[model samples]
Target: MIGYVTIGTNDIEKSKAFWCDLLEELGASVVMDAGRIAFIGNGSEKAMLAVCTPYDENAPHPGNGAMVAIDPGSKEMVEKLYARALELGATSDGEPGQRIPDMFYGAYFKDPDGNKACFYQFA
Candidate 1:
């Protein structure tokens, strides 16, 4: 029922580089690269994380109360990716840990474009 998620960015090149390096861990690469927009995928139908310039020609900003949640391969993968995100300049929103006993484990971060995302696993 889900398709893709788009994150706006004022600096398309910077956002692209950020994603390219980050997604390299998941074996994803640029599948669509237009001038102002780009997308990456690792052979998934849902691999549609886009970084784009605002169509209205205004500055890009993160939408309030909006976020994208990512489900990685495992808890260890989540931990690794979350740390890697910080190393690549993303800010930590939450540390990786069990969230709600017997329910889930997760970590959150704000991307270079200020788009917030989560990496989660279930126990």
Candidate 2:
């Protein structure tokens, strides 16, 4: 398992806004914002998201097939985060709903740079 993920974005400000909004919707707070990088989570003592500027415009966007799944605590929380992602300009991959019936409920969305991310609650 990975400890953290740092994604490179062409527009730092836009990326920051999108992620900050999404995290807030998931009940997490922005813990750090040092111009080029922004970290969001419960607090500075436990940052979970790290957003960084792309080294080059030609850098490839993260693929849709590679998704970062967030555990939003509950099905309702996942739904809320999914809605917030869409509200902030993310394109929908799927609507929030139950999946694998007995196992999960979630939704998927794509970030501006085409990175795929999802929020899910597992049973």
Candidate 3:
């Protein structure tokens, strides 16, 4: 139902670094940047992640039960991406594991501003 997703960040460079690393680790490539926005996607260029700058001083942080789930190909790939997120300064919300008792294999992490995000591979 959604055509695109964009998350606001206080520090664009930091957020960009975190996402650039995570996306590359997941085999996606960073494709465009127009000073205020950045886009990342698979080699086919689907335009998945959109990092945007906050428009107002009181704008809410990106994550608050909201999440963006990406297909990282395999369970191991998901795990690695999760770890890399942490290494790039994301905080842990949930560890890598099965979510639906063998139906969903996933991991949850937060961006620098505490936006809840996850990567999953269906089992």
Which candidate leads the pack in TM-score? 1
Clashes of each: 0, 0, 1
Residue by residue across 18-91, what tens digits does model 3's lDDT show?
88877885566556777777776764236478777865655557655689888788999889999989998899
Model 2 lDDT, full chain set = 0.79
Which 10 residues in a row give candidate 3 its minimum summed lDDT?
Answer: 38-47
TM-scores of the candidates are 0.93, 0.83, 0.87
**What does candidate 1's lDDT look like per residue over 1-123, in tens digits?**
666688999898899888888778888777788989888766447557888998898998898899988787899999999999999999999999999898899999999889999999988
- C-alpha positional error of residue 83 in candidate 1 after TM-score superposition, expressed in Å: 0.5
Q: TM-score of predicted model 1?
A: 0.93
C-alpha RMSD for every candidate: 1.3, 2.2, 2.0
Better of 2 and 3 by TM-score: 3
What C-alpha lDDT, on a 0 to 100 scale, does residue 56 get in candidate 1?
A: 92
The superposed Cα distance between candidate 2 and the true structure at residue 83, in angstroms, equals: 1.4
Off by over 4 Å in 3: 43-47, 56-60
